[model samples]
Target: MLKKSVTFVKGIGEEKAKDLHNLGIYSIQDLLEYFPFRYEDYRPKDITEIKHEERVTIQGTIQSESVLRFYGKKKSKISTRVLVGNVLLTAVFFNQHYLKTKLVIGSKVTLTGKWDQHRLSITVNECKFGIGEQNSSYEPVYSVGGKITVKGLKKMINSAMEQYGNQIKEILPPYYLQKYKLIERKDALYKLHYPLNFEDAKKARRRMVYEEFLLFQLKMQAIRKFHRENSGGASINYDKENVTLFLERLPFSLTSAQQRVVDEILKDMATPYRMNRLLQGDVGSGKTVVAAICLYAAVTARFQGALMVPTEILAEQHYHSLKALLEPVGITSELLTGSIKGKKRKELLTRLESGELNIIIGTHALIQDEVQFHKLGLVITDEQHRFGVEQRRTLRNKGLNPDVLFMTATPIPRTLAISIFGDMDVSTIDEMPAGRKPIETYWAKHQMLERVLSFVEKELMKGRQAYVICPLIEESDKLDVQNAIDVHAQLQHYFRDYKVGLMHGRLHSSEKEEVMQQFSNNEVQILVSTTVVEVGVNVPNATIMVIYDAERFGLSQLHQLRGRVGRGDAQSYCVLLADPKSDVGKERMKIMTETNNGFELSQRDLELRGPGDFFGSKQSGLPEFKIADMIHDYRALEVARNDATHLVSSEEFWENSEYKYLVMYLEEQGVLNGEKMD
Candidate 1:
């Protein structure tokens, strides 16, 4: 009954159902779970207990006739005096002249507004003709969108609950409910929508939040269990001798941190269980080399490999570098991006399917249906967060239980790792390679643009390249284009003796690649681009980074842009050219100058901004919780995770009669993929 369409409810037809669907409510269960964002206190308050600036609902008798006065054009104020017990106060409603005739002298009225104690005035948010019912104290406010009004949504919810509220099954077993002191599912829903007091409302909210978190964590636990027990792992033999020989031939040695991470990856791959891991490190931490070595290991074990990147430029760079390192050892590799087409693409696919190609590196092209691998044993994705979960799964499905390694230079905090990549084993390369100099960072005011440009000129004269980054205006693409163009034009005019290139999201992929190629080859002495350069665009000779309006970006993003340079041995400098007004903005610049550790910056970013702004909430692979917050409600998350881990690890959870409803619920919630967990 809970799975039934919302149209089954009374007063809801096709039109109303469509409106509700706009708010992500399609089933009776969804409608019930549509929790209120806030509540209005309709309970009358004592006049003496009302503090200044407090939102209070008070009942009183009208003492003065409503006076309607016009202030500015199109603005009106309706004022009336009300006497509650022995205290008198003035109620003012802005632009509500229609209430003048209703609020007559000697009539009773109840007003809900913010109290101004000194002036004895109430700025009325709502006014009733008579005293409100004591039982109807709290009114829930839904975040209604489209054509659905809050009042209409409330009525629909009440109707749905009246019809199917009892049918809603409890997700947790009675034992856990008793342990947590949680109310029944039906009662929680009732109190959530229509509470009698603040305590009841709080308890209901806690119960609902816990349920959501538990269900999500259970899903993650089930996934991990399935991976551990399933016979889907790759049968790879780690060629330690070949891997060591390959690493020894490299121009540079691996850092201790990188070596440790490599050991972890090799160990996971050597096992029979499928390896699901994330390799996160700061910029210039040599993640690419680690991936190359692992790919070589898989290839030497007689299994094919594939590396997917977010961009064609990054893919091409990886192909070139990996080919240089692996080709000498007889590891055949090829690049397959969107641009590779027709005869070349056909030949590449043929070779990949025939097991002739040992490794294939590409962009989204690697996930297409036409691409096939002959015994694909290793799958590595660079800048893993850029791709969606489905995209990654699609690529993995093309291979046979391949050992998957996700690489990202954008360091994520451990807390976030558990929330976002909960099922995967995480390894961090916390140390940069030896002899790599830290990027010198400075924050400069907008007025110092000339000085910053002059410094870049000196770097360019020394045969070094520079990057001038432009801020992305979230409001408009036209504005973004104009900003980048204006900056490019300004830089072009300033440095007439050198070549300047421009790049933005508006540019075609081929065009962007061409501009990047020029910059990489030092043909373009100065590259003026947007956040497009924040990712993998390696130019070792480019030592200068100047970002305009730098405060608009988050700390992680600023760190990413700073990572664009400093790839070279020479001293690199990053100049933040911003005129920030807010204290947070100033603090961001100050923090950037203070430290270059991406992990530390990520934690600070989570605190200063929020989880959403950390890496963009949508792309972070975080669940959209109705009531639970990833940061503020972290304690609840931890408890739920622990409980879920315990439950999923026990065989009784899958087979016991007491947990039948929970198992069924896992299916209903799609946490178990509509199947039994076992």
Candidate 2:
């Protein structure tokens, strides 16, 4: 049997264990549990159905053949003309003189390779003389590293299974297995790697995907349950009059959608239980204002509020904006960041400890040891996905069961939202503030650059700023396209009289902030940049956004870039420059031109690109599934989710032995016990 620890294995040493750690494999349990992403079936092909240029294997008799040598210093090519019955076929080998000795007159051989349709020939990669019909059969393709081949990997895995396969303990109870019709763990693992047929492989895959998602959801739900039971409820008093007075001082009225979301937040905070909510909004939908109102409520109840942002610039922006608004209401707000030093930092830390500061805004620096809150009741985080789970937990530790309100500008599809944020209650601001116009979007070929420039010049004449976005900050050796620097130069040459600002990732944070501030203050007429402006940089005056090589970006990213404009009352436009020859590119451009609804666009994006590519498997923090597709397998997901909910809700199973086994399995996966039930 494979031991619980990997060090007991034969080949793995301490140093090799570290290398496996990089791959998230630290124990023998981990290695045995690691599953393949996909399985390929290599069934034998019939010779009659094989067309020219098709990959196939054929057994045939080799007829008379001769080697023709060209008179030159260059390497000679060998040609063998083989006759199969009445049909004649030719095989050519380049710079391979050894092949001439392998094939003789009147010999039978089996060749496996792709055929060349133009020359009516087959290029052989694997060929053997006098091979039997027993060798012609199906094969399995496996993912392997540089040191391993498909056959070698299969051999090693099979050997390991022979010794430890049946030893795996089942974490799921027999009753639950029967209810879900899941196969045994050992059989599923073996069939998933090497199946008897395609149907068996698919069955194994279904069971594995269901098990992965079920375990993940159960762990999350258990953590939520623990948190709710241990963390005592907050006692914050509600005052609608205070909130009303604060809103009256605002420049504009809140939309109905925004008001509904604010109400949701207020209700959650007033309850005895600590609130764990997620506020999702579109680019221009006033989510920050809602967060500000929540902070106001907390401060009025004699409690402090903390707003944590992902970036330094965003934190500074929120600090200034909130200070300007709350100062008039006699509420003190301070900014704490790494940039503050000496006596000034010490003063802020002292104020935070004494509860003198009602609202504090900063980046991750707010979680420092010296920063203490006297009565922190509300914790709001912007762009919550940018911060890691442990980092957010650390910040929450600064308060006494503080309520958390996470805000995200990126609109997630409903299914994905449920999968990623299962522990938090979700609220969305679906409407934009009044006076924001829908951006006019269009797709054009590269030849229409002059027209696009002319439109930009017209927008500039109207006293509106414009943004030109390129895909890359610097030039890439592999792709032949214009970089941000090159594009900036080209735009400068075209509009020599117009003031243009350039921004890219290569610039320092301070430099980027300066350029963005210039654009926001109307100091620059045209801003040439990369996708660095996708988040947190708000320029309401910029009404035009032209993205170069728009085909290189995903639909969601393109939607965000388009959102940079149309933030003001002025009519805005987004021009997508792409090659018309690409059908997928054209379809993506069409989706952008159709609507400005982020939720709808997200659903369409999930359909166009599979969920893994849509969310980017590496960045999304979603569990990898071998068979369950988030888009195509929605039905299966729903069924499995319901099954997990039912299993966890049964009170009898809470302290049962089987439930304990499930909890142990989750702990083995690094999900520790926590308070809160999802």
Candidate 3:
């Protein structure tokens, strides 16, 4: 049953299967688990029994029908009225002209619409001919789109349940099920959609949510085990003399927080097991220096280290920064990207192969066929969320179980990070370097654009650089976000004396590199672009950031964009150009203006947008839950975490017969590879 395709399900043919696939139902299990988003209680009522503004289904014969059309400037409305029995029923449809023919005189029909007591009439929302039958029991209302309808989904799900309901094996042990007082798996599946009462429906949902949390915890633990038990790790040479020398040569002293994080990384690297660690920090928190320290350790231990980034601009930024930091101590660094080829590329690859280059930095090109390392001991990926799990794993596979360090500037809440990055040890550098001033932030209306532009002009004229950010690359009719193209043209005219540059993702790699270079070299005083600059480009002279349509972005995004300006010793200012009238929009503005703390803003973002499919992609290695909610299921999550932790800590728990289903589940999800377990 688990292996059966969706088309093989009863009542679902090729055409129906195509519709279901578009709705994300591709297998029998997917269909069976496609729980209803809501339930409908259908009860046929007489015309006199209906209440005002209440929906009801009534069966009667249409005595007369006529289409009444009303014209308007924006659009037109069409109304078709049917006199059935002793009630005057009106079917009002907006722009649905085809309904005129569907309602004919002397037609027996069942109409489901809203009853308006004040008007003494019924407004028809849905109509069907021939006095359609109404189900007396509860019905499931699915989320349908495209060529699929709710009725069709109900029919397919009902048919699927009839064939495979009894075939589902129990997931939880009898002891746990009894302790929790949960219902049977098959019964819960049926009751969730077609319950006798609302109480049973709640219980059914509880069952599903519990299972989701349980499996999620186990999957995370399985990944943790895979890294700890099987991955043959590197051993670091903890030479005190060399460490002291490297520290003394630095331009500035490390902060206490930075020094502590460095100590943690060194200790992890010194261990026999592989170090799977994540370094998180707010923008301008000196994370680069900590990473550079680790790279120095790897090179000193006679191993090659590679740093991969998502964009070419960031790769070049790291290349220059690391070189400036490491070259003074006799470590050679080289960069490999897609644009470099022929003799130059071959020479760099040969250096990497012969261990001549101790540190290598590049974008996706580093994972290509020609790039190889002699003794790749450590791998660091910047903006880890930007790359997929497969890409991260592919880079790790280049060496013999290399230690990995994933770094991110986006500050995720501590609890959420622990849960999400359950497979990796986490270290955070929460302190910014000295002499840096906090960026002054302001939330203003669109009417303040003139003043904002004047201030930006003054900043540019002071021999510093600035960035003008827009939400979209091109003009959009649907959204109100400012377009990068339109803004670029406007900025060029406004700042006629300064060099204005335009940038977006549509540009080529070399084109992007050139534009960024121009900006960094102070050739371009003002850059008008999208969020591409949010992650890359280091222009200390760029002290002012102007964001248009600021409400269109989340708090975390606003913080990251704001981080771009305050990198230098000069005071930076972020102008949020927006007129947010709505409550939600106003809240976003308030949060940004109140504080520049990324961790605090991240917590608020999580509260505003719940953790439902927030990190569902394989890039973050976070799974999507159907029936489970983080806020409502927080208690269940804690319970599952403790149980899963206990089970993973004990070796004998994996051999329990009651946990066979869990093992199968983990294996099916590709979280557990038996051959790699031992």
Which model scores highest in lDDT?
Answer: 1
lDDT tens digits by residue: candidate 2, 1-678: 465565555555686566556656566666665566654323434555668778766667777674756546767677787765566778766666677887888888777778776676777766667755432143455544544456644554565566567777777778867977889877888777767677777777777777777776776665555555566769678678988899999888999999999999999898777788999988889888898899999998898999999777788878877887789999999988878889999999899899988999999999988889999999999998778888898888889888899998888887777677766678999888877778999998889999999999999988888999998877899987668999998888998888889999889877987888788788888999998888777677888999999988888888888988887778999999988457777789899999998888888888888777787876676766644676766666666666666766677667778678786766665545443432
Which candidate's TM-score is highest? Answer: 1
Residue 359, model 3: lDDT of: 90
C-alpha lDDT of residue 539 in model 1: 97
Please give the TM-score that candidate 2 achieves against the real structure. Answer: 0.79
Report the Cα RMSD per candidate.
4.5, 5.1, 6.1
Which candidate would rank higher by lDDT, 2 or 3? 3
Q: What TM-score would every model get versus the actual structure? A: 0.83, 0.79, 0.77
Ranking by lDDT: 1, 3, 2
Q: For model 3, what is the error of residue 423's alpha carbon versus the real structure, in angstroms, after optimal superposition?
A: 4.8
lDDT of each: 0.87, 0.79, 0.82
**Candidate 3 per-residue C-alpha lDDT over 141-185 given as tens digits, one digit per residue, 9 for 90 to 100:** 788999888877878888888888778778887877897898988
- Which pairs of residues collide in candidate 1? none
Model 2 residue runs over 4 Å out of place are 4-42, 47-112, 115-138, 168-170, 174-180, 233-274, 311-357, 362-372, 387-394, 420-436, 471-481, 505-511, 578-595, 599-642, 658-660, 670-678
Q: Judge candidate 3 at residue 73 and give its lDDT.
A: 56
